[model samples]
Target: MKKGLFIFCFTMFIAFASKAQDNTSLPAKYQEKMTSIFNKIPEVTSSAATSLIDFAKSMLGKPYVYASSNPDRGFDCSGFVSYVFSNFGFKVPRSSREFAGAGTPVKLADAKVGDVLIFTGTNPRVRKIGHVGIIYSIENGEIKFIHSTSGKAHGVTVTEFNDYYKSRFMKAVSIVE
Candidate 1:
């Protein structure tokens, strides 16, 4: 079963790698970085990934509170991610910026449930990791993530990885194994 999963993930990685080659919006250097990161994703167990995702989902609709890691008082983006991973005994970084180098990077197209999705701050012009989320699902080619946002949703919500997010996407990472 593990071999089968690894094969499937590798095949998906190859397909996405080819597609990534055509994307010219991101600079060549950044593309290389992403590819390097994608190559380092470790084999992840589905059960663990599912458990983490389920725990994250249970917090749906929780209010968004900046700089907070407490579920009772709400959570900011990184705080929410930190809270979830910590529950599973994973010592993840506490801040979004710190996550850039936390775990093995996974390609966005190959991101799986429980993977961490990192994004630039609200202003895409500033290329720095300022937001984070947990991948909830990828259905029919549409990737959806669960995150705590201060946007229109105003709280912990599942959001589509649409153009808005794509523009700000920095990298995805896998911390579960």
Candidate 2:
């Protein structure tokens, strides 16, 4: 009887241990994994990110014209991004899709202000990158970006990485050292 009781107690302990490990929330586990992955990438200083962000902001209120890079005539999503980065003397890819594979990819959680945020449409029917933007800020742990959108806003604007974009977010690429 003592041996049977001991075996039962051991089985219960194993079950309890397994349950405790499985109890970890998915979000917490994801967060932990992201934190570790982000740690490997070099840190992006705020000053560097701010410099690129400032340039993008300077064109705020500019109209959004498809396939146009002319700031005076208005800028499209990729055009605006390429234009701004060109000013920094970096020749970036011309299309949003091209930009996706341009720089060293940094995870979204590790993205800094200057990192490039790629996205598909708000509805996200497509798997290709259709839009590009520069990370503008991280407010209250939320990532925001400055992009020229052809949406209702219809111009260069700063937007929070809310549910709309969050669901569409592809990945972030660090163009600046």
Models 1 onward score TM values of 0.74, 0.73
Q: Write candidate 1's Cα lDDT for 110-175 as tens digits.
A: 888889999998998899888998989988888999999988887899999999899999999999
lDDT of each: 0.88, 0.84
Worst 10 contiguous positions by lDDT, candidate 1: 36-45
Pairs clashing within candidate 1: none
lDDT of 2 by residue, 9-107 (tens): 978965764555543455775766755644543443356666777888899999999999999999999999999999988889999999878988998
- Poorest stretch of ten by lDDT in candidate 2: 37-46
lDDT for 158 (candidate 2): 94
Model 1 per-residue lDDT at 111: 80
